[model samples]
Target chain A: MRARIVDKNDILKIVDILRKDHEVIAPFQGRGRDSFFDVVTDANRDQVKMHLHNPYYPPKRYVLPHIEKLFDIDQAKMDVKAAYVEPKRAIFGIRSCDVHGIYHLDRFYLGRDYKDPYYERLRRGLFLVNVVCTDKELDIDNGCFCMCANTGPASTEHFDLQLMDLGDVYMAVAGSPKGEALFADPIFKRGDDSHVQRRRSILNEVRKHFKLAVNWYSAAVRYITTGQVPEELWAQVGNRCLECGACTYLCPACTCFTVADRKVDGKVVERVRLWDSCALSGFTRMAGGHNPRRAVHDRRNRRFFRKLAHYFVQRELSMACVGCGRCIDVCHGDIGMPSVVEIIRRGCAGKENDSTIIKR
Target chain B: MTQPSSNDKNIYLPKVAILDRVQDEIQEVKTFFWHFENPADQEEFKKFRPGQFAQVSIFSQGEFPASLPPSPTEKETFFTVRTVGSVTSGLHQLKAGDKFAVRGPYGNGFPMEQYYGRNLVFVAGGIGLIPLRSCIIYALANRDRYKKIQVFYGSRSPRELMYTQNLREWEKIEGFEFYTTVDRGDADWKGNVGVVGSLFKKPDVKVPVENTTAFVCGPPIMFRFVIKDLKDMGFHDRDIVSTLERYMKCGVGKCGHCCIGMAYVCTDGPVFTYEQIKKLGEDI
Candidate 1:
């Protein structure tokens, strides 16, 4: 199928068409500079902003909500019921970085051996409408590093419908059969090669717009995998980290969760999985109070090494980080991934750094 | 990918098991023998191995990753739970006939086949013996296949010692050396009184570093000291094996709580050699 075009006048029509049958969720402005992936409704249809900032939180909540009930237990009856409900949703205007985020999560939750039922249920039959991010404009915050993470500008797959801005009209590309079916609405027309060339030029022009860039990602991978990272560097990074765990929660690819049983009432109970972070000291602590990674530095080091190390990246088949940089905003101690990488890069380059400095 | 235990059931979905019998192991730890109300459930769960664990659940109280303390050779299945957290405390209040949920014999358990021709030395501190119990019993049951099996266990005091009945029985077995000690002695206690490592000082306790595999499990401080002692005794990092514990939400690897570096405690181990642990880059 040919790549199609949707004029500015028809953009809202496409959203309305999708919203008719499925629950449409799109980006909307949240007080001042904050952006959020909110449930878009007819009353707030005009509030949907395609070029708005990428939400501080990744779009993972659509599939893996922050808190989800995995099962319900009846104590008196002695039975377990899996709480899995798959709801059809059309998520619009997701950035390329976040599309990759979903892909990385797919690799984990839908593992070869054991697949998470709740996550699979939530992920089934999902419709994604992604907007290619050409620059830092539509939600690429300052600490962004998607270029190094290799999920930037645009995604060639996963998106049901991928849209690129071309001034008067948006170049729409269909990645799947479901995405091609949307072109049948007659609002889309076959896009010419000029439109493709315009996209290439725009990508070239916007390449320099990222506030952050990771030139030494491979260097960090080598040093981290080979265990060349000095112990003192980890201690330094650890001291700067507050162990708040905001970094992991805000990160688009961090998939760790903690489960607990909550009493809904006297006789009812629900087992829930809540987003958990390894930065917290209690994450690896045992029942009898023995924690292997007790030091703040050890936890800090583990997070980076797990994400960027060659062994894990190869095992996972993709680097866990898409470089969305949500960690930078949520971090209070200024030891987010970008900062940590810079520290490691500096150390690798033989520069002795002393303090944790937060810079945009 | 490791083969799924059940193709039909969700990995996280637990099976209901009734608490049938409870045996007091020590002051803080108790062994609970549980079986599924459905007889068919028992047949499938009988496949659990040594060093693996199950997620024991109490309806409104939550769940815990409790190691399977009963050997595969035993007809019954049980968890030797120590009251260390809220979940275990909730489990403590439950009586026989009260039902709870359990799923899995998770983790890469002690690779028994690899250690077939090697001498097995079991070292544990306090409640750490809970996991090693299954493997120790399995080794004892298959005694002809392996040579020279010894158990070195210690506790804070004589009263804190666990599985006294089994310990005494194992002591009576010919050629089976069972050594016990206490950090401090009691009036009625007449035995070696020192940390678990002190048991090595006994002239009869000979841990051959070559052609031998030593399994260690204990408190963090005890784990460190014991590993150091084993290294000093000329044991290779690969020769010393141990089971690790971590706060786990999902017994499957998806939940990140049990991960240290690249390895997830719920998957790659609860059982790992020192060489593997060192490469894992996470302190243990």
Candidate 2:
């Protein structure tokens, strides 16, 4: 069927419509230069920006919360009940790369026998309304290596309404039944041939402008098997390692967590699940007081291996790096994956260059 | 107990258990024996071996590692817990029909069959003796299957000694030497007065290196000194097996809690050699 069109200015109005039935979340620029998705309400109209680069953290945080209470137990009765929460949310302005990340999480959480009810709850509620990244500075500074990673400057799955901006008006293609139903409302109108052609050209332009080229498969392979390479190289790379877990936090595909049992009133309380990074020192501690990977550098190496070498290689999917580059900006040490990949390439070429060579 | 085996994943479920018995071993330590009221699990406890442990879950309080002081050979079921933290102290108040949850029979236990013919050296300090107590009693029961048996136990003071009555019963057995020591002796005490490591000073109990299997457990400081002494006394790292304590939230290897690099203490071992610990690059 023919798609519908809506003016760029009226995007917030659509959000107002969805808020009646769901909690509408949109991109709101937070402190510094970073953008994060915040729930859309009338109070933050000026704060919500529909057209911006990817956020400091992916949408995964909302679905898979950093700290979640999984289940609660009653000490007196000895009966246990799951802490189930269902908040209906409409996620507006999701970038294509973030959508791909949510897709991976969908498979990880839903594909397994033990389903994460918390993630599944928000996931089922989330309605995607994706917008095009028209700003080149947003594309470059964002550090999204989408083409090499082969996710997209646009997504084909997961998203409901795909909004491609054509300067004045936006061509809104209804990718799913929900999108079609939403489009059938009074606000949107049926589009002509030229509008659809305009969206095709706009998407093509976004893809043409994508910067930061990478050999994704080679980069992933090298990251896992890069052990034979010298520690001096990793030392040079490791020197920049800030030991911050931002890379895993921002990446759309990174999913490792830890659980803590929080007590209340001397009873077996709730199982609180939090985002855990292997970069932390206590990540591998056993009860009898044994900690493996005690060094900061080894933990740093483990994060890289987990994303590029381990989970991705084993799953035979692209390395979990969505090329979001939140790690680059978040890292105070300036030792993100892009610089690490350059070092890997240099090492693979057998050149004895240091960190200074990669910087230039 | 013998390490968790081919039973399916559900074996690790944390179920509510009632505290049926409690025994105070020392000022800060108490042992609790519990049973599953669900009736079905009363049968499930049949498979665990000596030296295996469970993650005792005290709701809202926290979970801690405690070994099955009762042998798997016993048809009756219970776990012996020592009160060390808030969760454990809370457990001391629990009595018959009071419920708590437990997840395990996790991690590898002492290799009983492999150590059958070897002289067994059990070196324990304070409550470290709890996990080792099962193996000691099991070996004592099957006395004919093993070689020389000896236990070198030490506690902070005479008051801190656990299972004293049981230790006395074990003392009366022939060919079994239960050498008890205290860091400092009280006026009424009339036993060896020194660290358990002092037992090595006596010459007649020298164990041959080739046919000796030693098991050690205690606070990290005690294990540090004791392991060094054993290595110095011609024992290889592999010949000595020690149970490790780490924060293991899930008895299965999936949770990152009990991980030591690639090794999950819940899966690969709670019992390991110095050789395995060396590759981990982690502190013990």
* Per-model B-chain TM-score: 0.95, 0.91
Residues A22-59, candidate 2, lDDT per residue (tens digit)?
A: 88888987666767788887789667776776777778
- Residue B199's lDDT within candidate 2 is 82
Candidate 1 local lDDT, residue A76: 67
lDDT per residue for candidate 1 within B1-284, as digits (tens), equals 12234423588887778899888887877889889766776787888879998888877777888888889999888888879888899888889988887888799899998999889999999989988999999999999989999899999998888988898898899978889989999899999988889888678778877899999998889999998999999999999999988888888899888887768889889899999888776666
> After superposing the true interface residues, what Cα RMSD does each candidate give?
1.7, 4.8
- The Cα local distance difference test for each model comes to 0.84, 0.72
Best candidate per TM-score, number?
A: 1
Could you estimate the TM-score for every candidate? 0.93, 0.69
Residue-wise C-alpha lDDT for candidate 1, range A1-360, written one tens digit per residue? 358989977887878989878888899888888888888887999988878778887889888899998877766666566777788898999888889889889888896478887888778868999897764565566877788788886777878999888888899989889988899898998878899899898878777888786557887887788677899989999999888888888887989888878988777788898998888888878776777778888888888987998877887788988877788878888987778887888886643233322331
DockQ of each: 0.69, 0.21
Location of the lowest summed lDDT over 10 successive residues in candidate 2 chain B = B1-10
